[model samples]
Structure formats: C-alpha cells, structure tokens
Target chain A: MWLAKNKDEREFTGGKTDWEAAARIAEQCSGFEPDDEDEQTADEAVSCYNCRYRRWTVKSFSCLLPT
Target chain B: MEIFVGIDDSRQLDGYKAGETASLLTRAIEDKGWGKSKIPSRHRLYPNPVIGYKKHNTARSFSADIDEQYLNPFITYACTMIKSNVASGCNAGLAVVVPERMVNRDDLISYAYRVKEEQVSKEECMQLAQCPGIYLFELSGDGRGVIGALAAAGLRLTGNDGQFRGKLKLGHEEYYVATVKEIIDKTYVQQVKSMDLVRLEDDETVRMGEKVKVVLLDNLYTLMVFPTDLENPKWQTSTTHMLRMF
Candidate 1:
C-alpha cells in the first residue's frame, strides 16, 4: 500500500521504520540500486531503504524514482 | 591551519549519490598534499518534496589540516573536481571556513538546525556566507546548492550534527571481535558505548559488526554498542540500522 501518491509526496505507507517491506520491495526492483553506504539506513544489503532515489520526509520517505 | 569544506547537490541525473562526490573531493584533498582529512560527515537537511535534487536532502563536509599558503590551491582543486565530475550540470554549492578566524555566530548554528526541519532561503545562505572567515562558492547549475553548502558548513562548525562517511572498518568483512579497549586503542574511535549512550567498560569484549562505524556525539567520534543474544561477547558494535537515528 502507498500513502500519498503524488509524484513527490508518495510514501510506502509502511512508515519509515519498515525494514522488511523495503528489502522485499527492493529485491525485485530493477531500479533498486543501493545508495551511498554512508547514507544507507537498512540492515539488509539491498533495499529501497538504501536506494539513491528515496527522498526522505519527516515521517516516511517518498519514492521519487518511477516504478 | 584547519579547513572545513561543505558540498551539496552533486547528484547526477542518473542516480549518483551526493556522498560519493564528497568522499572523492576529500580524497583529492589528501592526494594533493593539502592535508589529510577526517572522514566526510553527512549532514541532513529539510526534505521538501518540491525542492532539491536527488533522493535525500543532505550535505557532506569534512575538515583538513594544511599550510595556510595551500588553501587557495586546495579550494581551486576541489572546485575543479566538482565541476568536472560531481556537479556536471547540477547546482553544486561549496563552502570553506576556518573556525579559528570565522566570526563565531550562533546564527549559523541556528541556521543549520533550521534547515533540518524546514526550508531555508538562498538569501539567508548568502547573508550568512558574508560573515568574516566564511567563503562560499557555487560550482555549477542553478546555484541553489549554496543554501545547503552554507548550512553544511554551519553543521560542521557545531560538530554535533551528522554521521561520518564510510565504515569505521574493524577486523574483517564477516565480523570483528575485540575488547572495547582494543577498538579505541587501534582505531580513532574515542569510546565504545551502547545505543542509550552508556559507555562500555574497556575490559568488555564486543563482537564488532561487519562494516562497524561511529557516530559524532558530544563532538567526539563515538562507537556505540549493544547486547547480543546470551553470548560471551556481551556487547556488539552498533549497526547501520542503529546509527541511522543520528
């Protein structure tokens, strides 16, 4: 599920702390390239949480890259 | 003299991370013999949906020690690197400051904290950059990056915001094992504490996690640790999962 679907404000709706959901989404995501190591927040190696395209918001991050 | 460098908006149209530009710039600073640098630190800023490029809104900064004479050349070198590689048609901003000579301004610190929670104006960045000892330069594109660069320099001056770039690098890729004392003795890590900020005793052994890293707290490079499941290695180095709270 997604929260705000607006191009910029779209969030995963799983909230900011959902590590498993992020990793699962990333495993199959063709665009899920890892972000800079310094900025990665997730425990799993490959996750949208660590992607270079997830623009962070106050409560959750918005996926700025197209699916 | 010690020099502080702040950079932001280096992300390319393709998905290059901002920290990559920062770490490369710092590496060049060291390679050029200007001086060795402390690890680049990432200072996050307000994330507005409509503003800025890249995935996350953050800036990177580092401090290096060099002879005062080489300062100009070093800045030139850095600016050239950003233009040629990092910024490439992007609005990259750069700020260099000498803490000792810069007029101490609580306003600068306030400005940094403000950007973390809300949008800031380029006018504010320009005004703050005018303070003595502060030098601000735009490397490419629309120059909106000046706001973030100034904010990052402010964050660096405070020494309290952000996490160091790269891992602290302990034992090996799998896992590292050492006493809390050994970590501090061998590495620049000042202390091995827990998530709650409790400093572990030197004698306690911690199974340092793979790619273990440190956080800046109380203006010190800190290695925060936590407990493992009913094990002899009573404490464990903080993980990327844990340090993200910074």
Candidate 2:
C-alpha cells in the first residue's frame, strides 16, 4: 500500500515524507492491485484514522487500493 | 432552519392550503431542534402567483382545479424562504420544488432536490422553469461541474466530477429528494467557449489526494475523507462502508 499526505497535510507539512510513513506502517503492501489479501488488510484497517480511506462512510475494503 | 415555502395557485386546490402547510413545517423543524441553537428561524410570508380556476383532468368538467398564472411567483417564494432561513442564521438553504404529479397521488414520488445557499443565474432559472415537471433544490456553490462531490448521491452522470449533495423529503411520506452538482470545465474551441465535460475520473493508477464529505442522514453524522485516490477500490469500498458506520 502506498500513501500520500492529505491536502491539508501538504500545506501544513513541507516534506512529502507522510507517504513513506503510511507505506512503512501498512500491514500488507502492494503496487495498486485489487486482491483478497489487500481487501482483508483494508477491512482490518477500517475505522483507522490514518488509513487511506479515512473519513469514509462505508466499510468497503476498496480503501486500501494502493492509494 | 427558517423556511418560507410558496405554492403556486395551480397547486392551491380547494382542499390544499400553503400557509397551513408552512406553519406545520416550521413546527417540525422546531421540534427537531429541541430548544437548542438548532431552533427554527422566523419565516416571512408571501402570497404569489394568483390562483385561476382551470380544468386539470380531461376526464370530466368536475376535475377543474386552481392553478397559477405564472411560475415566477412560486420561485420568488422559494427565494424568500432561503433569505429568511439564512437571515435567521441557519446552516444552509433547503428549497422544495413541488410538481403536479405529486398531488393526490397514491404511489410514492421521488422529487429532485438541490441544497446550496448560493445564487443561480437567471438563464439557469429559465431553463429549469421550462421543465416544470422536474423538481429542484438549489444549494450553495457555482452551479458549475467543479462541485460534483457536494451533491453526490442518487446522481447518474457519466464522465463528470459532481459534488454529491444529499436528499430531502417533501409533502407526505411519498417523496424523496436527492442532489448532485456536475463539474463544468472549459474547452477552448477557437472562438467558441465550449464546455469540456468529464465524469468523476478514477485515480487508481496514481497516488493522489482525495477529499470526501459524507452525510449519514440515518445518524445525522457527516464524514469527510481526504487524500485518497479515486481509482483505489479500497478507498471507494471504505467510503461506501463509512456511510453506514454509525
């Protein structure tokens, strides 16, 4: 899983290091493919404020799709 | 929120009364507030579009009903409702676009809704007026396509980024209202200022930032997501799941 800082984060934090921060902490990492393992990771990562799909209204695993 | 609803004379049949309906709606809003800062605002009354008796159903002469001479008066009423609601310090404007099909119908009806406190141009208003059969709800923002996410639900537009505003109910329990704003970008075609329209593009390949605002009406909670890629199925599925998280 790859990650990028939010818009507000970019403005607040000058470095692009937030991407590495999320990527390093990601349980299962991939290069943008939708797989069952990725889906499970996404499900477990649900409700995580630092997850790629944070602030989501749904519990779908698509949130971890290499974003 | 304070809302001033205007009914066209065409809508004002012998048994239908706009004033009484408005009063009831005000009470409902007030009751929802529970004496908090959410209390409803003061409404300004107005009588627009004089009523004229006209035959509605061609089945019989007795099917005649009262109708409006013009639609402007009803639109004016909606504007007044927004003005009063905003002046009273409500969060946003909520207009109800009623249709003839909604009257005396046994089946449930789905009315269209827009929910911004912004101003719409006269040309857009005219276009909408021509289609009186369609209901409308005006929300804040330039009626442009850039705000597609504001009104995202219940919209079925292809290749356009739309702000998904939510839905509203009208009249009885038979109606539901939803809204979406289409993003309109410009395409320069020589001397022609053509609009280059694109649907909500997927960002599956690239790791871009995303911003999402979700309103859970069932729970009355709003979720805002940011910096997520569009094409990421995880993001999409998660966003959908979060809608019902409460």
Candidate 3:
C-alpha cells in the first residue's frame, strides 16, 4: 500500500516494520533497486526497505523512484 | 598508542561511499608502517531531515595500535586522502581520538549518544574538540561532517555501537553451518552469541545464512544468532533486519 503525497512522491503505508508488505510491494515494483549492503534493513533480499530509491522519513519511508 | 580514526563523508547520490574511504585509510596505515588497524565499523547517526544527508546518515571508524611518534604523519595523510576523495558539492570530516589522553572520557561518550538521539551541531562538536587527545577536521564543503565524524569515534569507543563495514564470508553456498569454534577459526569473529546475548559454547553449532555479518560487541567481533527451531535449539545467523539496531 502507498500514499500519494504529490504528483511524483509517495510513501509506504506499511511504515518501517511491515516487512511482509514492503517485500510484497517491492516484488511488483519495477524500480526496486537494492541499496548499498550497509543500508539494507530487511531480511528479504527484495524489499522496499532495501530499495535504493527509498528515502527514510520520520514515520515511514518514501519512494524516490519517479512515478 | 591506540587511536580511533573516524570519518564521515556527505557525497553526491552516486558518488563514492564513505565506508570505502574508511577501509582505504586502514590499508594505508599498514602500508606505510604507521600501525595495525582493526576492521572499520559503521555507526548510525540521527536520521532527522535537518541533517540533509544523501541517504542513510552514518559514519565509519576504526581503531589502530600505532607508534606514538607517527601520530602527526598519520593525521596529515588521512586529511589529504579524505580531501582528495570527497566528491564535488559535498563535505567530509575526520577525527582522531586517543582515549587515554582525553581530559574526560565520559563527556565524549555522552556527547556521542546525544548525537544519536537528537539534533547535533558543528559548534557542539567543536566545543568537545577542545579536550586533549581529540582532534577534528573538516576536509571539504561546509564542514558539517565533523559532527558525525566525532560522534563516530565516541560510538566506537563505547565498544557497543555500530556494525563492522563488511560481511564475513565463510562459505560458497547460500548458507554455511559450523561450530562456534570453527566459525571463530575461519573468520575474525571472537565470540558467537544468541539473540539474548548468551554466548554459545565452543561445541554449539550455528547455521550462517547467505550474508554473515558481525557486530562490535564488548569490544570484540561478535556474531549473533537466533534459534531456527526452538525444539531442537538450532542457531542461525542474524539477518540484516535483525542487526539494524547495531
């Protein structure tokens, strides 16, 4: 699930700890690129929390990939 | 004398990583016969938007046992390396701390925790730098990186924060299973423990996943594991998400 903050910005509705949701969403997203090894935080190899385009926000994280 | 070298680099989105720079510094120290360096660790800083970091807000640092006479030369070389490697439109900071010579070690440790939980400024770091045995430098740009660099040294001194920079490769497959003693023999890991901080016995077995990582715990390279099956009490290496707190 995602919340559209603007024309090109969106945030993950699952917040930071929703590993299953983040992984599910990333699996379908074409722009999901794995971040640096040190930055990745998810056990799943492919997850939004591990995506290079995801920018961490105070409450959750936002997708930086152009929508 | 033993010293900790801390570095933080704020670079372009696609520029070189600060961790790589930290690793290079360790190699340089050995190549120049300056000292024997330990593995560099990555310390996480407060992620507030005010910091304006490119991605994750983190700094890298490592400890070294060196000849006291070479201190100045090492510092000068580090400064030059960081200045040249920093990317355009970015800032980099370097800090060299000798704990034994510090005026008050507690003050630096407290400041380090504050940087992790709250907004810290360059002025605060500058004030702390006045203490003996602590040196801070701003290599490029606006020099905000000094905040993280100083904090990184403090965290490293605590010996409880941060994870080592790279993974521990013990096998060629997706997973590797070994006894606690065997794991220690194959890698730099000095201790193996469960999630609850209970140290596993030498004969205890562990299943290491694809990415085996170690954290700086109790001043040693510690590998943490969780039970794969409570009934059988099988241990497995902690995953990336599990080690995020470090």
Candidate 4:
C-alpha cells in the first residue's frame, strides 16, 4: 500500500513477503516517527521492576518483564 | 497472489472409521458458521484459497462491506477448499501468506490515541516565547510521534481486524462479543480445523480397548473411533469393525 504524496487515502495490491522483508517494507512505507519526549518516556519505563522474585539477574534478563 | 501448502498425503493411518468420526467436525463448523457463504463439497483435504492475500488499509470491518469489495469471493473459495480438503484426507497444518505494505486502520488509531493519552499529556507542553509569535511545540507535532512510540513499544500501529478475523473464517473459529460499541470488544474461539467428513454427534460414546485417534483442530481436542458392534445385542470392543481415515 502506498499513500499519494500529501494524501490520507492509499492504494494496494497483493504481493509476497517474509518476516524480514515485511519489516523492511513497513519501515519504508511508514510516514511518521515519534517525537523525543515520547521516546524518553517509553525508555524510562521500568519493564523489569516486577521481576523481584529471582536469585540471579543478568544484564540481558534485566530487560525482560516478569512473566 | 498465490500461496502454496505442502501436504504429506501418503501417510495414512488405516483400520479406523471415517463416517463415525465426521459428525463432531460438522457440528463444530455449524457452531462457528465460518464457511456459510462457500459452496460445500466432499474431499479429504484441499488448500485454502484465502491464505495469500494482502489486507489493504481501506477495507471495511463488516462482512457485507468486504463482500462489496470482492474479498468475499476469495473467502468463499478458501472455505470451499477447506471443506473439500477435510472431506478428502488432507490432515496437516495450514500456511497463510500476506503482503506487508497494507496497514490496518484500527491498529494505527489505537496506537495513536494511546500515545497521545499516555506520553504527551497536556502538562508536557512547552511554550515558545521568543519566536515572535506564541507557539506550543507539543500541540503541532504530527503522527510520526505516535508511530515512534508504537515502534519503541514493539507494537504495530496500522493493523485492522483483518488478520485476526481472517484466521477465524479459515479455521471455523467461534467468538462472542463482550462489548458492542468498543472497537476491541470482539474475541475469538476456534471451533474446528475444517468442515470436511469428520465430526462429533451428540449420541456417541467411546469405550476403552477400542481403536481411536486424537483429532486436534484449532483448540478443540477430540477422540475418534469406529464402532465394534453394529448387529450384536451387546457391543464389545472385540467385535468392532474398523474402516480407514478416521
């Protein structure tokens, strides 16, 4: 699907895709990006704070939220 | 677009009944009514035609709207394929392929509203005093801000109900709406893998020492078997007759 320049409506036709290819296409087709404040707030969220019940916490695991 | 599914048909576990086990499947499909519009046919297994189409952004949510847009023809084709496939003996997982460029409006709006409400509250607005005219920086930001927040959150902001609803149609999924007005109020429950020849009926019972195969379709699990005694006064496991393709 491609939106005409400065237009909200778009056109689309079916095509083949894989996961990686889909991601690349999405990135290219997407027209907007978030502002800095939104990014900072998202970054500040303590996604791992609920993971307090553990004997060990690795750096990689620190980024994971409690299941 | 074309989608291909590889089916291993040579693997057939014989010595079981096919007719006795089909009612459960039919009842399940009837309950979901996913294939109501398609022409019914008999076969072991056939490829679903609805597997490989892209979901464009402007498509409507109502089935009627989709039919007007010519999507229903493909959906009907897919349903018919599934019905035929199940009838014939195709037992395997389905593969669906779709284009990535299409965006779902519901997903995009949902993400956008979430970003506005959660991240950029009114208190965060910064007033520019020295720009010759008054300007609030936050008030003028575009959708890029919302998209960025969604990206950071690992969320796709442009998907509609097409992907979710399409699977339901293909697999004979069941669902109930919890809320009528909300966009996200709908839910799904898969009823059957296909509406072919195998099914479960109300007055059927399976006993131990009888041959049976576990049928797993969507999320429902069932046991299939052929009767041991059709003429004897007392049906015993030892006297049962077995047929192929259960």
Candidate 5:
C-alpha cells in the first residue's frame, strides 16, 4: 500500500482513486489530520487523501510523516 | 457592473488558505457596500510536481455585481488585504476581469484550459494581461501565483468550472430530504441537477447527505445529485469523489 520514497516519506501505491484503501490506511495512522474542508477529496471523513500531511504527486501522493 | 475576482496564494502548509482569503474578500465587499458578491469558487489547476506548489494546486475566485465607481478602490483593497494576510516568503497573485469590457474572452478561456492541461508560465500570463478589461497583480514573492490567478478568472468566466468553496448547511441532521425549490430558497444554489446535467424539477425531491456542496454550472450555482436507488429513482447529493472533477 505504500512505497518508501525516502527516510521520512512514503508514497501511496494506490495512486489517486483508491478511496477504500486510502481510508483504511488513514484509519490506522496516528498522524492523520483532516485537510481543509475544500481540499478534501474523499467521502470518508477520515482518509489519507483528505489528510493534511499528504502531498499530491504526479501519480499518487506522498505522506510527509516520518517513517 | 459585474466583475470576477481571482486570487492565488502560495502560503505555507500551515498558513491561511487562498479560499479563506477569497471568502474574506467576498464578505468585505458586501460589508463595504461595494457590491453584492457571489459565493467563491475553488479552481483546481495543473498539479504537476514541477510547478512546486506546497500542497494542492488550486485558486479561489468569485463574481460580484458592484458599483462601477468602486472598481479601483476594490482592487486596491483586495491587493492590500492579500499582501497582509499571506504568509511570509510566499507568492500571491490577483486577477480582476470585467467580462463586458473584455474584447478577447475566448483567448482567456483557452489559456485557462491550457493552464489546467500543461505547465503555464508567469510570462504567458503577463502577456495575456495586455488584453483589455483584464487586470493582474503580483502581491508578493516571485509572482508565480499570477499564473493561477489569471487562470482562475478565466475558468470562472467560462461559467462551467470549479466547485464553490465550503458547504451548504440545509438541515441539522447528518442526512435530510428536501424539495429542489426548498433547497434553492435556503441556499445560494440556483438549480438542482443530476450527475448527467439534467435539471431537476422544482417539485422533485432530493436526499442531501453530509457536507452538501454546490458547483458552478451554466453560470448558476448548481447542486448536483445522483440517483440514490435506481429502483425508486430518488435523488441524493453527489459525494466528494463524484464532484472531484469540478
């Protein structure tokens, strides 16, 4: 579900459309914080796609949280 | 006179958002009696990593029917507000367009679509600013935000782009049902339509879920819904995922 991009960053392997996977992963993640309401894309109130720490990349997104 | 205002702020991850600034501008306009402003909309721009945005690549814009005399003062106020509110070391841009005075709207519209499709530069945006009735300003930093600001104005002019910032609170419950006419009366939504773009009749019923939002469509505030149960043909507000394209 994640690809280690660096020592402190990991990218979501599901790309941009895997809502269920993103939500599942976010549910267990302690660092997850909801982004601005307008920026949130997931219907699930708690999802990585809606996390403030997730930075969108070309293919998917990178978690800014330290690994 | 009617004018469209667009702003792009490249603030830090923890800084105030561009949408919030746009919203503040809208309220300030109304409070100053400068104009009756519409709900602000958020335009999603090209998200390529090369552009180097801190987070989501988006801009906020809104339209207002203001006294033509207040145009210059309004612009000055907007510029000052953005500069003061934006985070340090960030770039902020402002674009104002008077559609009635614009001679080459098609060119601006095409540029907007191009910005969403590929990498657009500040030089290109500055070049387009030469067109009449279009104003662009660099409030801070390297002024790269002008690219998004200008694109935002053009996208808003298209009358068919961007989701409105924030949500509509119709009922206190997590989910509630209302007629299309009732929804229109309670909120800025001018029309209710299906995902396929078919307008729902005023008498039609809809079940609005949590965080109901509206989008710009055909130059009106539109609330889009989808059939909740095909068997019953009941309508329900679109989910966040469904409205992502806007």
Candidate 6:
C-alpha cells in the first residue's frame, strides 16, 4: 500500500486487478476484517480486497484506515 | 398478486450494510404473515463517485406472492420498518411494483438502466414511480435513495443483474460433490452450469465449495461451475471473485 494524497490514508499500490498480491498484503495486516459477503470480491477469504476499510476506487481501492 | 419491492441507500454511513436491508425487510414481511417471500437479490448500481457515493452503491430487492387484501397493510408495515430500522441520518428509498397495476413496464425498466449509465434526478425518480399501482416512499434524510430503490426494482423486474445475498451453504463442511438434481433439491440454487456456458444435465456431478452462491445470468439464477480436470463428475463452484463480474 502507498500513501495517498490524504494524510494517514493508504491505497493499494498494486491496484485492484492483482488479486493474489492484494491477498498477500492482507495476510499481514491486522485490520483485515472481511466486509459483508456480497461486497467481497476476493476468492481468498482473508484478502485486502475483502477488507472492510478498503474504499473502492474505479481502478483500485484506498485503505480507509490509518497506516 | 406479485409484489416486487426494492430498497436502496437504506443504511446509515455508520450503520448496517445497505446490502443486508432487503433480507431483513423480507423477513419482517413473512413474520407478519403477509406472504412467503424468496431470498433477496442485491443489485449493483453504477459505482460513480461523482454521485456522492464511493463504495457499495447497491440496492436490495425481492419478489413475493402476496394476498391482495394484505397489500395496503404490507406497504404500510414496510414503510414503518424502514423509518424505524434504517440508520438515522441516512437517505432511505423504497419502491413497490404490483405487476397487475403497472400496465406499462418498459418505462419502469428503462429507469433501472438509466441509473446505471446516466445521472437521474429525484424528480425524475418520483415522477416515474408516481404511477398507478407503483408506490415510492422516502423514509429519511434527502430521500435520494429513491434513485437506487426505483432502479433496483426495474433491474429485478428485468430478471437480470445482481448476486443473491449470502453464500449458499452446500456440500461438506468444506467441500464436496453433488449431482445437479441434488443441488437443485437441497438448496435454493435454481440451476447449475459450466463456465463454458453449457447448462449441465440434471444427473451431471458438480463439486462445489462449502460457500456456494448463485448469480443472475441470462435472466436466471445460475451457479457457474467449472470442471476440475475436464472429467465426468469433476466440477467446482465459481469463486466470488469470478462471480463479481456480473
């Protein structure tokens, strides 16, 4: 995740298409609580793509939590 | 009579997920003995950020075969529930369609597609919904939810778009195989098909994950499974990652 223009906000640098990378990043994050089942897009249950604070962007999602 | 209900933006920014509202409301309807309802469908709308929405701009909708006499009370009860259950400071929208009353449905469905591709105003939404037999209610806040609520009803009425809420818990605790006939009988899964676009025969074997779910495709609630190794009786459910494209 890279620092967004907003202070303390981070976005998935790998973008949204790279599913495995997103899941790998989520595997190490403590804030990876899954969102609702319908909102989840990752096949892996514990992926950042499924993270509750990952505000979805048209290209990639920005991590809403402070990093 | 058939009553198709759609609700959108019903959850507060800090409250329940908007995707879950329809299921909760449908359960409330059944609990009141108005009629038996089917599982709700979560229809995805345009995810345009310019619309003041950044995430989860989806609507919840379902259809029910209800008694004609219960119609008035049902709508009244539903409106009351939205006001009470929806998060405070949230914009809640609700739309109900009685097939017999909506003499011309093309206009209704057209609005559903319009929300997906263009910007629609609250005035347009109310005008379209202000027809005979079609009821539109704004529960709270700016009532912008009517935009998504009416759109959802149109999409659901078209019999396409959206994924069914909740994972279909089938097979073993983790994974197992079942015949297509058994899949239909044991679960709400209407039909099973291959990712290659072929509908599997009723007797064909399909291996599925514990968390199986169906999506709306070709106007049918379908479970797209893939062959494990192109062999007979070797198939697995399509992952949520794949199904999300719908």
Interface RMSD of each: 2.3, 21.5, 1.8, 24.9, 1.5, 2.1
Which stretches of model 1 miss by more than 4 angstroms? A4-9, A28-31, A65-67, B11-18, B87-89, B229-231
Q: What is the TM-score of chain A alone in each candidate?
A: 0.85, 0.20, 0.94, 0.21, 0.94, 0.86
The runs of at least 3 residues in candidate 2 whose Cα sits more than 4 Å from the true structure, single-residue gaps closed, are A5-67, B1-78, B84-95, B101-129, B135-246
Segments of candidate 6 deviating more than 4 angstroms: A1-5, A8-15, B10-14, B51-55, B117-119, B218-220
- Which residue pairs clash within candidate 5? none
Candidate with better TM-score, 5 vs 6:
5
**All models: lDDT?**
0.77, 0.23, 0.86, 0.22, 0.88, 0.77
lDDT tens per residue, model 2, B1-246: 111132211111133222333344444433544221111111111111111111010000000111243234434543455434332111122233233533321111111113121222334533443443333343222222111111121111111111122221122323111111111111110111101211123222211112222222211122223223433421221232332211
Which candidate number maximizes lDDT?
5
Off by over 4 Å in 3: A1-9, B230-233
Clashing residue pair totals per candidate (backbone < 3 A): 1, 57, 0, 27, 0, 0
Which tens-of-lDDT digit does each residue in B1-246 have in candidate 5?
A: 999998988746778578889988999999999989988999988775765536877888999999999999999999999988888767889999999998879999999988877788788899999989999999988888898999999999999999987788887776788889999998889999899999999888888888788999999999999998743338999998999878
Number of the predicted model whose DockQ against the real structure is largest? 5
Answer with 2 or 4, whichever has the higher lDDT: 2
Give the C-alpha miss distance for residue B240 in model 3, angstroms: 1.5
Candidate order by decreasing DockQ: 5, 1, 3, 6, 2, 4
Model 5 chain B — which ten-residue stretch has the worst lDDT? B47-56
- Candidate 5 at A26: error in angstroms? 0.9
Candidate 6's TM-score reads 0.88
Candidate 3 per-residue lDDT over residues B1-246, each given as its tens digit: 999888988745667578998999899989999889999999987765664435667888999999999999999999998888888867788999998898799999999889887788788899999999999999899888888899999999999888986678887766677889999998999999888999999988888788878999999999999999843438999988788778
